[model samples]
Target: MLRRSGLQALQALLELARHGQQWSSVSAIATAQELPAPMLEQLLLQLRRAELVESRRGRQGGYRLSRAPEAIPVAEVLDAVGAPLQLSEGPAEGSDGRAETQVLQSMGQRLQNAIERELKQLTLQELLFDLESWKEYLSNEGGLMLG
Candidate 1:
């Protein structure tokens, strides 16, 4: 699962994509996505540094996607927000140098790699489509029911 910042960044990006190449103010995005403006601004700064989004100054200035939605991968967005998917480091301390430990470590690394590969193939455009589908489904279902 994504951290709060990563989720917020994705939401903000989706909002921008929905608007096409038009620049969107931080406040506008925050309000639309229900994210905190201050934190969203910081996340946008990180994204700008990563070159995932571009920003402009002045009264009519704000931020917009640096590339088309299809060109920006979900992995790239997570990376830009400093939330790269990764498994926790090696086994716990004080563990004996056992073959089982090594096997588990290798498996963990392989799993992480597979996750990264899938994420790389998933772009913002795809996610946006999925998001819309989910919204429609939920609405048709009269929202989700929790036990």
Candidate 2:
């Protein structure tokens, strides 16, 4: 499972993607996403280190995606945020639990494979577009505020 922090980081990046080529400040992103500034700062730093985003300094300084949203895979964001798709092994066991371990391992591998495959196919641009469409639909249909 992806960590909560990873999900938060993904949300922050999605927020940045919504801005296109423009730079976005941590405060603005956090405020918009209802996330803590400190958490977003750390996530941005991690993403920068991963070369997913670049940071600027000074009064008008902020962060922007290093590459186009369409080029960045969702898996890359998860990787940048340290959300690994693999599973960890449990304690060593004797022959009694060998079959159970094998079964669990197979299931875990299948799950990870499916998740990675889907995530690799997803891009921030597509995700943002879908979200915008959904928000529009909801607002028109039910008068809900998604922003």
Candidate 3:
């Protein structure tokens, strides 16, 4: 599961991409996505630092994707927002401490690797293309609750 901030960051970028090359203000994105403006602004800052989005200043100031959405991978967005696949830390203190821990760690590693591989293959463009399904699911199922 992604943290709330991570989801917001992704949404913010999606909004930017949806506009093509046009800049989207933080307020516009926040309103469109129903996310908090301040928080979205913060998330955009992180994305800017990661070079995923570029900002303009002055009256028409806002943000636009730094490059084409197809060039930005899902993993890059997640990494930019510090949302990586999470895994169990391992058993507390069971029968086989070292062995059990190793097994758990191994399993976590495999899962993480698989997730990373999949994410690498998915780009913001693909994600945006599938946005309609996501919105429908979210509306029908009350959406995913980000931590």
Once fitted onto the true fold, the runs of candidate 3 whose alpha carbons sit more than 4 angstroms away are: 92-101, 133-147
Best candidate, lDDT-wise?
A: 1
**lDDT (tens digit, per residue) of candidate 3 on 86-107:** 5555565454767767777777
Question: 21-128, model 1: which lDDT tens digit per residue?
Answer: 898999999999998899999999999999989999989889999999999999999998888877778776337788888788778878989999999999999888
- Write down the worst ten-residue block by lDDT for model 3: 86-95
Tell me the deviation in Å of residue 128 in model 3. 0.7
Task: Give the root-mean-square deviation of each candidate in angstroms.
Answer: 3.9, 3.5, 5.2
* All candidates: TM-score: 0.86, 0.82, 0.81
lDDT by residue for model 2 over 1-147, one digit each (tens)? 678877887788888888887889999999999999998899999999999999999788899899988998988998888886656654444435678877776777787788889899988888787778777867747644343
Q: How close is candidate 3 to the true structure, as a TM-score?
A: 0.81
Report lDDT (Cα) of residue 51, candidate 2. 96
**Where does candidate 2 have its weakest 10-residue lDDT segment?**
87-96
Write down the TM-score for model 2: 0.82
Clash totals, every prediction: 0, 0, 0
Task: Tell me the deviation in Å of residue 147 in model 2.
Answer: 19
**In candidate 1, which residue pairs get closer than 3 Å at backbone N, Cα or C atoms, i.e. clash?**
none
